[model samples]
Target: MSRKIKVLQLQNRYNVNASDLAEQVIQGLPAERFEVTTAFLRGRPGPGEPESRAARSIYFGFSQSDLKGLRLRALWRLYRLWREQRYDVVIAHRFKPMNMLMLLNRCLRIPACIGVQHGIGDFDRAYRRWEARRLLTANWRIVGVSRAVRDYLVGCGAGFDAGNTVQINNAIDIDRAERLQHPREQARSLLGLAREPFIFGAIGRLVPVKGHIHLIEAFAQVQSVYPQAQLAIIGEGRMRAELEAAIARFGLGGKVQLLGAREDALQYVRAFDAFVMPSLSEGLPLALLEGMSGHLPVIGSDIPSLRPILEDCGGRIFPVGDVATLAKQLGAVLNLDAEQRRAEGERAYSYLRGAHAIEDFRLQYLQLIEQSLAAERAAL
Candidate 1:
C-alpha cells in the first residue's frame, strides 16, 4: 500500500475565519490518501473558541518579540520541527509564516510548498520582494485569496507570475452559516434593535481601512432625506472613540448605532434590512460572502476585489471612500420595494451558490495539492 502523504498547515495566529478556512483544507483531503497537521506560531483557542480540526494540532506559543526582526529562535524551532516531521507538503498562510517557510524550506528541501496570500500590499517592501525572488524554487507555489491579489503578486515583480500564482476565492460553508443565523425578528430582538427602522447594517472592524467613517458620514446625509434610515455597525476596535466622536458630531446618536463586537456576529445579520461593506481594500472578504449567504441585498466599494463580486451578484457598489456616492447608492437601495429588494438579494445568493460554494473551493484546493505532489514526483 502507498504511504499516506503528510502535510503541514502553518498559520501565524489562531483567527476564527482563518481557522475555518484551514479546517476546509483539512476536511477536503481524503483520509486514506493524506494526513494533515495544523500549527499556530502564536495564540491558542480561548474558551469557547474553535480549535484546529486537522488530524493533529500544535501551538508554538511564541511571543510577538520572538517573531520580530530576524526571528532566529523561531526559525530554529520551526526548522527542528520541520526536520523531525519531514512533511511531504508545507502550506503557510499570510506573510510572516510564508516568509519563514520560504527561508527554511531552502535548507529542509520540502517536496512541495504553498504560500497563501490573504491580502494585497504584503510584498510592498523591496527586501520582501528580493527574498521571494531569491528563495523561491520550482517546488514553490503562491495562492492569492482573490484575483486582485493574484494580479498584485504577479505585477509586483516579486518572483510570482501567472505560472506560479493562482486565485482561489475565499468561501464559506453556506449550510452551516445559514443554519447559525437567527430569524429576522429574533435577531433584531437579540441586537436590541427596533423593527420600525430601515436598518443598513455593516460587519467589520472599526478601522480606517473599513471606511466606517465614510459610511457614517454618508448615513448622516441618508437620514436627513429618509429619517427612518438607520445604520448599525457590528465589531469593535481602536477606532471606536473616533467613530463615536463622528456619531456625536453628526448628532446621529439614535440613528447610527455602533453595536460593539459580538461573537458569531453573522448569526444576527438577519437584523439588517440591507448589508453594506464599504472597505477601502480587501482580499476577497469572507464577511461579504457571509452576508450574501444570509440572502441580504449587499453594497460594497468599487475596489477591484469587491467590484466583480458585487456587480456579478447584482449587488450595489460605490466609489471607495466617496461619502457622497455611498449615500447615493444607499438611497437607491432604499428606493427598492420589499419584493424588489428580496429579488436582488436572491440574485446574490444564487451567484454565491454557483461561484463561491465550499464544494468548489474544496475541489480546487485538492486539485492543486494533487498536482503539486505529481509535479514533485516528476522532478524526482
Candidate 2:
C-alpha cells in the first residue's frame, strides 16, 4: 500500500473568521490519502475558541518580538520541526509563515510548498519581493485568496507569475453558518436592538481600511430621510474612538450603535434588515458571504474584490469610499418592499450556493494539492 502523504498547514495565529480558511484546508483533504498537521506560529486558541481540525496540531507560542526582524529563533525552531517531520507538503498562510517556509524550503526542499496570500500589498516592500524571487523554486506555488489578490501577486514582480500563481476564492461552511445563526427576533434581542427600526448592519474591524467612517457618513444621510433606519456595527479595533467621534459628529448617538466585538458575530446577522460592507479594500470578505448566507439584501463598495460578487449576486455596489454613492445605494435598498427585498436576498443566496459553495472550494484545494504532488512525482 502507498504511504499517506503528510502535510503541514502553518498559520501566524488563530483568529475566529480569519482562521476558518486554514481550517477548511484541514477538513477538505481526504483522510485516506493524506495526514495533515496544523501549526500556529504565535498564539494558541483561547477558551471557546475554535481549534484546528487537522490530524495533529502544534502551537509554537512565540511572542511578537520573536517573529520580527531576522526571526532567527523562530526560523531555527521551524527548521528543526520541518527536519524532524520531513513533511511531503507545506501550506503556509499569509506572509510570515510563508516567508519562513520559503527560506527554509530552499535547503530542506519540501516536495510541494504552497503559500496562500489573503490580501493585497503584501509584497510592497523591495526586500520581501527580492527574498521571494530568490528563494522560490520549481516546487513552490502561490495561491491568492481572490482573483484581485492573484493579479496583485502576478503584477508585483515578485517571481509570482501566472505560471506559478492561482486564485482560490475564500469560502465558508454554509450549512454550519446557517445552523449557528439565531432567529431574527432572538438575534435582535441579543443585540439590544428594537424590532421597530430598520437596522442596517456591518461586521468588521473599525479600521480605516474597513471604511467604517464612510459607512457612518452614508448611514447619516439615509437616517435623515428615514428616521426608522438605524445602523449597527460589530467588531472592535483601534479606530473605535474615531468611529465614535464620527457618530457624534453626525448626531447619530442613539440611532447608530457600535456593538463592539462579539464572539460568533455571524449568529447576530439576522438582526439586520439589510447588510452593508463599505470596505475600501478586501480579498474576498467572508463576512459579506456570511451575510448572503443569512439571506439578507446586501450593499458594498465597488472595489475589485467585492464588485463581481455583489454584481453577480444582485447586491447594490457604490464606488469605493464615496459616501454619497454609498448613501444612495443604502436608500435604494431601503426603498424595497419586504417581498422585493426578500427576492433580492434570495438572488444573493442562490449565487453563493452556485459559486462559493464549500464543496467546490474543497474540491479545488484537493485538486491543487494532488496536482502539485503529481508534478513532483513526474519530475522525480
**Who wins the TM-score comparison?**
1
Model 1: lDDT of residue 100: 97
- TM-scores of all candidate predictions against the true structure: 0.95, 0.93
TM-score of candidate 1 versus the correct structure, residues matched by position: 0.95
After TM-score superposition, what is the CA distance of residue 312 in candidate 2 from its true location, in Å?
A: 2.7
Model 2 over residues 248-292: C-alpha lDDT tens digits? 999999999999999879989899989999999887599999999
Separate clash counts for every candidate: 0, 0
Candidate 2 lDDT at 126 equals 98
Instruction: Name the regions of candidate 1 deviating beyond 4 angstroms.
Output: 16-19
TM-score of 2: 0.93
